[model samples]
Target: MPPRPRRRPSDRTTRARLASVLALCLVAVGSTSTLPPASAHEGAADPAHAYYGILGANALDLTTLTGTGVTAVSLEVGWDRLEPQRGRVDPVYAAQVAGRAEQIRAAGLDVILDAGLQYPPSWVFDVGGDTRFVNQYGDVWQGQVGARVPDAVFNPRVRRAQNRYLHRLSAVLDDGPIAAIRVGGLWYNELHYPPATVGDHRNSLWAFSPTAQAQSPVPGYRPGQGTTEETAAFLTWYLEEINDYGMWQLRHYRRAFGWRPTLQLLLPGWGVRPGDVDKAVAGGLRGATRGELTGALNEGLDWAGLLPRAATVRGHNEAYTTWVDAADQGTDPVYESPVRHLVRLAEPLGLPVAGENTGTNSPEEMQRSVDRVHELGLTGLVWMNAAQLQDGRWATLDDYRRLLAP
Candidate 1:
């Protein structure tokens, strides 16, 4: 077993409070803060209880993973496929999910339902309450994903549909051999804004949607377009909304799924070009407007703000399962803890943390990820794939097997 991860000192007292914030920004959303803690995950941080698994275990030979120290499958059961209509839960599709779970259980593995809530249905956009995400250029994004995903985080009509889907889907899997539900977000299953690849590329802000603007903290202020203080205040509100979106789902899942299975998330790595998440406040990301910090800012993530808030969800059973991979030994400070950063932030919060390698990185890079998975006393690691093993990228599957083996 790996040594448990340790947390470093951080100032929890520091926050930039801008007085110009309006009252409308305080819109009350769902609350998990009141739920009594029921997700004790048995061996959350205990190193001896570490688990090893495959994410898309259904794709590659299941037999290859069955007896190889792997015990779980992180399956992305897309919402669009399950509930294609607004108020209906497709019986045939629901049965298909149960069958898939049974099949994995039959293989001697448990299933972690990756709640693909990000998979919006066609009918939802039709019910439109400014349901699409409008970038600054007014380019309404349906995301690169094939679904007509909605701006559910800010759009109440869309969120109500998503809420219904969550409750329905959770009730379907509530009594099964499911292990946990990885609370997904608006695309890629990671909680963040869709890559705003307009003029400035991924640096574009996505909070310009009509529902978003009507709800902005300051009526006329836009992120990066206002005074420096106004930009800071707007950025703060934007990040908080993103954080609340995550909590809203976690709370909704707990209500429908009950406290049986742990509710978790798959967060992306810090993707800014300059790499310092601190630059989110003061740095260069010059776009059509100035003060634009990409990555965490545009992406709507800041684990410093997120991890602490996550722990409040049903007390400790919430986890941090990685949907990210390592490009090298994350030991390279230049990479700024790109891989282990989330793990470190979450460790102190007592939220169970884990790892995942997309299997698309270089063999050496993947090998380093395996090293971190084994080294960090995380809940466990899930290989989100294995086409690498199939395509002869590694000399053999044993490259992964041995690291997993005692």
Candidate 2:
């Protein structure tokens, strides 16, 4: 070939651009930045100690939570947020959520994801409708608290849809990189009343969904007319279903990441009895003989056996000292040491447990509650309402961090 004339600088510039474009393509195809390592509590050198966090940004100011030297971040994700419409997940929200998880992981902090089914979509309820009670606000002050019914939980069609939604969420987050997962929170609030009630209505809130009610396997059992035995059976089935769902998520996460994520149960209102231990014992088992019902209603359910492999079980004790102080009027010895009974109920579970909402606003209350938690060998404690952190009333975040330090 004949010698070619020298090319112009413009031709050289074009070649350089082509080379840069090829390099960018290769970088996008082959190279990937590794996600920061997750910091889980179970794998820590000191398993007994744990730093507490809050439920999403609502529980605490995000700015403060990140700056507080917290090792973990807990947040509640609602069903509505996960799947707003049928089979249509919001990619924007999902990306934002995943980004938050990635950010927490990047910061070398753990993330706890809490999910719940109590709140139904607004479309499920209507004014003067049979399922109006499904709405969060249903005339609280008046004697009429609405019907307290949501067709979604009980309806088979809705249940299937909800289950599918859960599966989609699992698929999205399984590889998104998070530490812990709390599959339940105040789960029984709408299912069962605070104290044991006689009617099946209280126990069958899940039946509010027509689809669930229709597909219910129990024969000859009307939704509201079912007896306590029938209700118990229904709850057993429901809880088993939920447990399976949780296990499915855990398995998916493990299959995707080759490591089991922490599982947790966030109980509503501490899951503890309010009055004296003897009174609670009696109240929990009204008609049954002594020793029939444990001091707490939850103790009667044998949750530990149902979800034996859960990594953590956190209770919410909003008024610990207030309840204890009120119960002090009794001369009964059982009332004097309610914490002892509380600890006894949780000891056999063999999993890390914590108090999510400690009612220790005062120094004395904080000290007493901390002493009781330590005496019981509980894992740790988390205070609700991060705004209180700056109040300087009880143990602040710094104080709790120090107390839980390894």
Question: Candidate 2: where are CA atoms >4 Å away?
Answer: 1-48, 56-69, 116-119, 123-154, 171-176, 185-259, 269-349, 358-360, 391-395
lDDT per residue, candidate 1, 31-57, as tens digits? Answer: 223322222222335555676666554
Clashing pairs in 2: 56-75, 151-208, 151-209, 154-212, 155-209, 155-211, 155-212, 156-211, 156-212, 270-316
Clashes of each: 0, 10
Candidate topping TM-score? 1
lDDT string, candidate 2, 77-154, tens digits: 555566777677778767756666666666666776544344334443432224421211122111111212243323
**Best candidate, lDDT-wise?**
1
List residue ranges in candidate 1 displaced over 4 A. 1-46, 59-61, 146-148, 199-202, 271-294, 315-324, 327-335, 386-388, 394-396
